[model samples]
Structures are given as C-alpha cells and as structure tokens.
Target chain A: MVLVAIILSACAPGTPDEDSWRVDALRSIGDVSSSVSSVQLALQHHDRLFGPYLQTVAVQAEDAAGTASTKLSAVQPPEPYQGRSDTVTSALDDAESLLTDARIAVVRRDSAAYADLVRRLKRTGDRLSRIEDRIRALPDDRSRP
Target chain B: MKKLLNVALGVLTAIGGFVDIGDLVTNAQVGARFGLSLAWVTLLGVVGIIVFAEMSGRIAAVSGRATFDLVRERLGPAMGMANLLGSMGVTLLTYVAEIGGVALAFQLICGVDYLLLFPFVGALVWLVLWRAKFSVIENLFGLLGLALIVFVVALLKLGPDWSQLGHSAVSFQPPKPEAWSTWAYYAVALFGAAMTPYEVFFFSSGGVEEKWGVKDIGVMRTNVLLGFPLGGVLSVAIAACTYVVFNPLSASVDTLGQVGLPVAIALGKIGLAIALLGFVAATFGAACETGLSTGYSIAQYFGWQWGKFVRTDVAARFHLVLLLSTVIALGVLATGIDPVQVTEASVVFSALALPLTYFPILVVANDRDYMGEHVNGRVLNVLAMFFMVVLTVVALAAIPLMIWTRMGA
Candidate 1:
C-alpha cells in the first residue's frame, strides 16, 4: 500500500515535451515486463538446464532498467512531446500488469501460460524499445525556433 | 557410555533441527545480496536463539511446562491467544514451505516433478510422526542432515577472498544499487529465519517431552549454545558460497537451484548431490518440527495433550491438528507455488511476528517464580532487552520495506 503511494507520488503529471520521455519510459517498462515473461516461460518447461540461469540474468537486467526509468521519470519534460505523458502512464500500467502476470504464472507453475505471456511481452518490449530509440533520435523541441 | 551416546545424539539432533528451510533460503538470499556484510545478523541471531533456547529449556526443566504452556499461564488467555495465533501462523506457513522444499529437493535429484513427489513426501513425514520413536525421529534426520556439511566443503573449494569477506563483515555498508531499506529488509529476514519462533517452542517442548531436569540443564545448554552456533556456521557457509558465486554478478536468488549453484560450481555433480540431500533432510526434518509445533503451540495454549511420547489415539485432537496442518501445507504446495519463494515470505512474516513470542519469553525468563535461580542475570537481561528493541524496530521496518521494494522486486 505504501509502495503504491510512493510510486504514484513519484510519478509527476506529464508536461508537454515529456511525451517522448514518457513513451520511452513506457517502452522500457514493457521490455522489462516481456523479459520477465520470457524467463517465466522458460522456467515452466521444466528446462532446468538454463531456465533459472536465464531468469536470474533477465530479472537483474529488468531491475536495473526499471531503476533507470524511475530516474528518467523525475526529469523535466521536453517541449512538443508535452501531452503524451498520459499515454506513457497508461503504458506503464500495462507494463505493471504484464509483470504481475509473469509473477502469478511463476507462483502458479503455469509454464505454458508463462511462455505465452512472455511472447506477448517480448513483442510489447520490442515496440517500446523502437519507440524509445526513435525518441532518442528526435531533435530537441526546446531548441526549435 | 550409553548416556554419553544419548547426549551426543541429542546435540546432533539439535543442530540438524536448528537450521531449517527458512534458514537455508534466507541465508542464501542474504549471502547473495550483501555478501558477508550482514553476517553479523546471523551472529546476533545465534546469540539470541541460544539465550532464549537455554531459558526455555531451563523453564521446562524447572516447571515441567513447555514454553507455550508457560506463555498462557504467564501472559493470561488474551495475550497468549494473540501470541499463539501469530506464532502458529508463521510456523504453519513455514511448515508448508518446508514440505514444498523437500519435494523440490526430490525433484532435483530424481528428475521428476516436485509436485508428483508432494503426496509421497507428505505421507512420509506423517508416518515418521506417527510410527517412529521420538528419539529415532530426532536422531535419524537430525544426523542425516549433516549432509549439509557439503556447503562447508564447497566453501573451502571456492576459497573466497578471506580478507575481502572479513572486510565486508567489519565495514558494513549497504551494497551499491541497494537502498538501506532493502538492506535492512534482508537483515530482518536473516534474523527472523535464524530466531524463528518454532525453534524455541519445539526446544522447550522437546525438553519437557524428554523429561529434562536440573541435571540435564548442562546438556541442554550445551545443545543450545554449541549446537546453534554450529548451525550458524552452516548458515555462514551457505551465505559465503552464494556471495562468492552470485553477488559479483548481481544475481538475485529466487530458486533452490540458485542456492545450490555455488556448491555445484565448487564441487561439481557430487557437490550438487550432497547439497540436494541436505536440502531434503533439512526441509523434511523441519516439516516434522513445524508440523508438530503447530499442534504443540495450540494444544499447549488450550491445555491439551501433545507429543509423540503419547500414542496417536491418546492425543487424538493433537494428532488431528498435526495431520491437518501437514495436509493443508501439501495442498498449498499442490497449487504450484514456488516453495523457495514461500519460504522467503514465511521468514519475512516470521520477522513481523518475532516480538509477540520473544516478549513473553523475556518476561518469563526474568520471573523468579518460574525460573527461580535460573532467572536471567543482569547481563542476560540487558542483552534480551536490547534484542527486544531491535526486534521491534525490525518488525516496524519490515512491512514498509516489503511494500517499497515490492517484496524485494
């Protein structure tokens, strides 16, 4: 309960130029959610060979990335990307749900379900990474006359 | 000579039974997270367990009453009931996790699904409780759990940078990328796992069941003081192995496989096999202890007969609770939850529930009416008071950290 409050209060209302940043944040969230799903799927198959090893790596990466996004979320919004903060927030919601689903699958031992969720999550991640990449490539609207 | 052997056996059982699934998982997790930075917590926990276990054993020796029995008489019904509920819940959840842990160990060794082994594991645990002699049950798994020494062996094989580990132990700072909240959270987990309530409940109750008297106090203290720190050594070895293997990579331990990975790396397949056996024996033994403890606390609270010293038909209700608790634990595991994760959560909850049990014990330990000459001295009193305060603060921080870290993410 307290965590939810912290996360909510930490998330400031999106500004105009924050659109691309928000998109990047949402995409990163999606990527992490997908990665968790993939690891969950691998674990479900009883493939002890590499499943746990992979999951360990994946979770570590996701945690690092999530921390980064949280930091990025604190930065000021850029111009031109202003109104899309809501879109980013909604994407974060989706990402959180995906991650939650992955956790549930792990607890339930539903490997098949985990695999399917991972595939969807990966696609979501790919889309987000692409969006993030595009945003990084975009010119600063603040400098635009 | 026979008496000497019995004492030796008793000490071994105490050590084997001391470190359960909770200790195994939490020690590994903390080792992976903080290296030896929080090793002090285990040392602190070892001292706490020894002090309380000795007090409980002494109380049972003097009064012929188990810990919970004294709890009810000392604290009255309302407060006793509250402690009973809290301790029983944490112990029972741990019981469930141990059952799962045993099955997971079987899965690792036999290449079969752990869920498939769950029923057999549950039945085997029940049978031991039903038919095995009290001393035999204590001696058998208690001695067999020595297989966990493989952890110590593995630690030797890994040959960690001793100076660095020593440095981390002395110069404690929360590791990089980890907030103080999370570091504090794992510390509470380690402390709670080491000083779990059931250990005291079982220790005191077992002393009474074995009919320990003043003469046995020496042996009991030996078991508490020596056996627990030895158990802590095993815990340190586990954490050290995990630290050497996982900490550098920034990997979190989420499964038993990860817990055993360091052993596997150090000692190869033989090491893995031994560690898995240790896991099974530790968890299986704990399943019996916690299963029995569930009944022990409740029956003692309500003034009912309990223990394997009595026949099944004699303590029907007590046996019924034992059977029911095992079944419920198995059912929870059958739902496919990771026993490792369940074990982690159980330890965390145990942290939350520590004070309820410890406070009453501290009070009872100080009471001359019960403890007589065995009552805590000034030094023991000061230490107990310090732990009580530490426990309270840890309990306060546990929930908030769990929330903030999303259960450590």
Candidate 2:
C-alpha cells in the first residue's frame, strides 16, 4: 500500500517546487545527453557496426530523446523556474531533432553525412552536459510549496 | 571417457547458460556507470546461487523430486503457495522479457522492428519447449551461448589497465557523481540478476527431467562448482568491456545495441556478429528455461504430472500451463511494452522473490525425511544460514531501494 501510494503520488501532476523541478529537468537533460552520446559512438564506428545494429541504436536514441522532451514538457514548473525548464526542454528538442537526422542517415547508410552528424551530435551532447552541470551547481532555494 | 565427456558437457552448458537477459543488461549498465565498483555484488550473488543450487540439486538427486514438489511436501501448501506466487510471478515476467529480448536480438540482426517479431519469437519458444528434449534444449543453447566468451576476448583486446580495474573492484565505494543509495540500488539489481529464482527452479527440475539419482550428484556438483564461477567471470568480463569503452565517456547503457557496442569497438564486424548470435542464444535459451519453470512451479505445486521426461500427452496440464504462459506473455508484449524495462523490473522483483524461493530449499535440504543420510552438514549449514540472512536483507531492501532511487534514475 505504501509503495502504491508513493508511485501514485509521483504520477500525479502538480507544479513541482524549485528544487524538485530542477531535479526532474536535470534528469531529462541527462537522458537526452546519454542518448545523443550513444548515436555519436555508433556513428563513429559505423563501418564496423552492422547496418541493422546501427539503425537500431540510432532509432532507440531518437526515441529516448523524444521521450525526454515529452516528459520535461509535461512538467509544470513553478513560476520562477519556468525559464530554466524551458531552456532544458529546448535543448532536448534540439537533441531530438539531431537524433532524428542521425537515424535517417543511418537508415540510408549515407557515409558522407556521418561526419557532420557526429559533429553536431557531440556538440549538442556537450551542451546538454553543460546544462546538467549548471543545474547541479544551482542553489536549492526550496522556497515554494 | 563417456562419463568424463558427460561431466565436461554439463560444466560447459552451465557456463554458457549462466548469463540471461537480466545479467546482460544489468551488468552492462553497472559497468558503464560504476565501472568495477559493483563487481563484488556479482561475485557475492554467484556464490549465493551456487550454495542454493547445489542444495536443490542434492534434494532432487536424493529425493527423486524437484524443488517445488518437495517445497509443498516439506513446507505445507500455504508456504508453498507463497513460494509459488513469488517465484512463478517473476519467472513469468522474465519469460515475457526473454521472448522480447530474442526479438530484439533478431531486430539487431535483420533490421526489423521487435514488435513485428514478437509473435514469431513467442511461437518459436513455445515450439522448442513443447518439442525439444530436455538435454537438447539445455545443451544446444548453452553451448551456443558460449559465443559470449567473445566478451572475455573483447576485454583483453581493449587492453584496460589491470591495476586500475583491480583498484575499482576493491573500492567498495561508489565512484564520484554516484550517491550511496544509487550504488546500493544497482548492487541489489546485480545480485538479483545474478541469482534469479528461475535458474534454481530450472536446475532442480531439469535434474528430475534427466532422471538423476545419487550417482549424478558428482556431475551436478562439478557443474555448480566449476561452471558457475566461470560464468561469473563472463559476467565481470561483460562489465569490464563496457567499463573500458563507455565509462570514460560517462555514458549509460540503455539499449541492447549499446550492450554489444563494446564488442564492435574492440573486435570489429565479425565480433559484433558473434555477439549478436550470443544474444539470441542466451535470451532464447533463458526464454525456454523460464517458460518451463513457470509450468514446473504450478504443476508441481498442484500435484499435476510434470517434466519433459514424460510425454507431453502424459503431462497434459503441465504442457497446458506452458502453452498458456507463452500466449499470455505474447499478449503482454503485443501491447508494445519495452522489453528492457520488463527485464529491469523482473530483476528487482526477482530479488524480492529470492527468500521466498530459497528458504524452502534450505528447509527441505535439512529434513532427514527427504535426505536420509545426506542432510546438510554443519559447515554447509553455516554457509547456507549466512546466505539466508543475506537473502532476507536483500529481499527486504529491494522495493524500498527501488522506490528511493526512483529505479536508479
């Protein structure tokens, strides 16, 4: 019963206070960052990777990024933290878009586009990582209920 | 020489069949996040499993009965029901995940979506369970799963700093950026993955299916003692492979493809192809085992005739349970659930189910009625008692840790 209650409360939608909002936002960022880095790694070894394996990895990355974007978007951030939430969500959007492009390149087996896609993915991934670090460094002003 | 060959085969199969989808995903995820810091959990879990499995095998050998059959007789129907519910529940969940895992493996190989392949994977697993002989199902997939040895080869090819890996293995502390709760959560997951209930259920039941008596105890002991540690080595090799490749990048393994990526990085296309084969065999093998385990637990509890040693027609209800389980598992997967998520849940719940499944074995093993002169000795009793405490602690901690860590978010 306690487990069910905790899970139910977690699923209930409410505007999280600043600290929890930051934690949720950073989790989304971390997920997208991991997905983006997966694509970068897969693309770097595309020649050695099987075509189907490459496609599967790329598609999973895109799905993960898409899910992170949707999850972060669903979070009703408290008024003061709305800007930070939007920034993280926007970064996720970019990551999702890059992942989609990477997936297409992988499906088409376009070696020529691989280099640029890897570069873009790494840059976006690095940006997401930096965002996570910044959020981690932020002071937890648990002022709002 | 024939007897020697039989022992050799049993050991080889045990080593190959040791890893299932849970071990594959959890070990890779831990290695990626914590390096070798959690390696001790896998070792601890392996020893725990070996202790119980040997006792269960001994029970089967001496009593001419499987674990669940003896569980009900020794512990009474009420406690047997409790064990059945916990162990069978996780085994069924694991059954679904292993079928889906096979589809995922096929998807990686053929570029088809796993959803498209689920029905076929489900049917194929059912067909094998229904048609294959006990030893054939055990040996074919187990030997094929030896392809996972590529992980050992992959780790060597990666040329990791041995001293650094040894240091992490001994660290016992979580690495930077990991909290103790998160480390503890993964530790429980690793233990759960290493010592899932189905393995023992399958082992004890398989002994019955093969019609083992006292003479076969030597072969069983050889397999458990020699085979399981080697299998543990393979588990650590998988972690070390991912640790060498993904740890430096601070990435996590969230997909099946990522679990096999380290092999591609180290040994190129052929190695990747071999790893994919390993995935298919390991998951498919476990799918068969867990599927049978579900039937074994229920039929044995209900006093229905069970075991592949009997004709399918003779053990009608047991076969029916296997068929229904496959259809239900497929039904669950048809709703488009993520197999990896199912795999994760199965391991955690497997931890929760550990004591329920294991305590009965310890009790029955000590009962002189079942083991005339073969009751657990003082030394073995001390060891098993220690593990019982550990299992109880792990079982109690599993859900709370899962909740607190938000499933190791």
How does chain A of candidate 1 score by TM-score against the true chain A? 0.53
Candidate 2 ranges beyond 4 A from true positions? A1-15, A140-145
Off by over 4 Å in 1: A1-145
Error of 2 at B202 (Å): 0.4
Strongest candidate by DockQ: 2
The DockQ of each candidate is: 0.07, 0.61
lDDT of candidate 1 over B326-370, digit per residue (tens): 889888988878787798888888888889988998888889998
| Inter-residue clash pairs, candidate 1 | A16-A81, A16-A82, A17-A78, A17-A79, A17-A82, A19-A81
Please provide, for model 2 over A10-120, each residue's C-alpha lDDT reduced to its tens digit, 9 standing for 90 to 100: 874355767667767877887888899888999999999989999999998898889878988987988877667777888889889889999998999898999999999
Candidate 1 local lDDT, residue A120 = 64
Interface RMSD of 1: 8.2
lDDT of 2: 0.91
RMSD of each: 7.8, 2.1
Q: What is the lDDT of residue B338 in candidate 2?
A: 93
